[model samples]
Target: MSPNGIISISILALQLWHCAADLCNWTGSGFGADGDSRTVLQVRLRCTEGSVRWVYPGQALRVVLEPNLSYAQRTTVCIKPSRTFRGASVYIERAGELELLMTDGGRPEQVFCFRADGPQRPAIYLQASPQSDVSRPMVGFRYELLGNRSAAPNLGHSGLQTSCRPCNDTELLMAICNSDFVVRGYIKNVSHDPERQSSLVEVSGGRVYWQRSGVFEQEEGTVGASRSVSSWHGHIHTLLQCHVKPGGGEFLFTGSEHFGEAWLGCAPRYKDFLSVYQTARAARRNSCDFPLD
Candidate 1:
């Protein structure tokens, strides 16, 4: 399962499928191009790899994608893109790529391909049946990739520095649950705390905004839960940490002001950061509790 426990599949007919259609291996015979029996680039089916999530100090999530292929009817094949890269919601990131295996199976073993990392596109594709003398073409093909990540998926290939993130309103509250940060926990205290140090966040849905940390620190400011905004039914979460010293330490939560309400409400969903990123991209929409404005 690669080093990160990601199961690899050389072939994917069905069940637990994650490989690209292009990997199916295309040849000279084949079908319609993109246009028709005559067009040179017909889009059959497309499947994409997951996104990237959290990586520690030095790690990277690598993904390779290609199209399913075959040349049953005088067809020439090429890979359309089949992989992507994503970052946290708070920050903006351009589309990214992974190295793809050559269709012909030659020396340069792999090349790079980009996944649809923009807004609104999900990881999906079509499997085209080349137009032939017969009604529905009989021959079909598949695609594949060599997807794997480093020891720390959270870190990028460049070893981007990553800090702790207070998920959305849900996880943020959960993170706050056991801490002293919510000393007043009344969701009523929308005001920033000048004495308390750490970021706060509240997720209503997919929206995400930020609030300043009240406590003094030499690092980035803290964000309150109420800062995120649930937009267009998509989760947009941001992680804000109450800057503390390096190394493992204690997370002091001040519980809600309510007599029975718990602070930081619950525990954030624990997941690999790189996985989170890739999942978000492939789904084309996030499912986080976005903080409000």
Candidate 2:
């Protein structure tokens, strides 16, 4: 289940200064430093529609700066989102792009909590951008990963876990993660004509669901009409539990292409198998544009 709202840490709201016309970077000299001087340490991060993007050589994230500090060796200031999406935090970059870092970490996830602290696991250190801080004899520190600062009570995570790699063919990626909170995924593709070819997202114990082709509107429970969503604002249909269940859940896609669609049926969860229904609703509608982020 998703929370109604989320909170942001003060550091998560760092002051940002403009850099190049096409870019903005964080440059703060704490404690000591001169305009002519520099530091050998820095934290790297970026905001986007999905997870924060770190402009690494390959556009990847994660790296250790060799800092000697124990706790919070350092931290990154986060800029809260201007709005919300799919019941998650919304972040804005200096470029005006939006993003959110949703992770299953401890209730009070410090960016490192995964699976909501349900279990201990490897650290998912995220980096946006790092700078050299010669003023301090330090390498750098690791900041938190994506997600709300205050994890939901049931926010389950076991730290960083892996799944079957999408080696070019990911048609099966959707079917696999449709069963539990543990079975979640990230989107690598977006934009499929906009009018059609919506993206998909599969979660543990949930099927690959999609967006309803409209903006952020509260959907009707199952057995209702086909909901409308904003195309540009992009509604994130959490088929994870919308159409299938009739047990007081919103999200049902009653259209032609889905009349008799069949799939690998599994034992259902939720009193009326809420998860299964939503997954199927998303699967059949062709409206599940969930992989954008």
Tens digits of per-residue lDDT for model 1 on 1-293?
Answer: 14432232223222222222242232222222222322222122333222222211011111233233331121111222212211101111123211222222122211123223334222222222223333332222222222221111122222112235445442343333233222211121222333322234332222112212222112232359555432211111112233322222112222221111122322233233324434554675444332222
State TM-scores per candidate.
Answer: 0.17, 0.20
Q: Against the hidden true structure, what lDDT does model 1 obtain?
A: 0.25
lDDT of each: 0.25, 0.24
Worst-scoring 10-residue span by lDDT in model 1 = 84-93
Error of 1 at 26 (Å): 8.1
- When summed lDDT is taken over every stretch of 10 residues in candidate 2, the lowest stretch is 254-263
TM-score leader: 2
How do the residues 181-248 of candidate 2 rate in per-residue lDDT, one tens digit apiece?
11112222222222221222222212224322222223234344775432111112222222322222
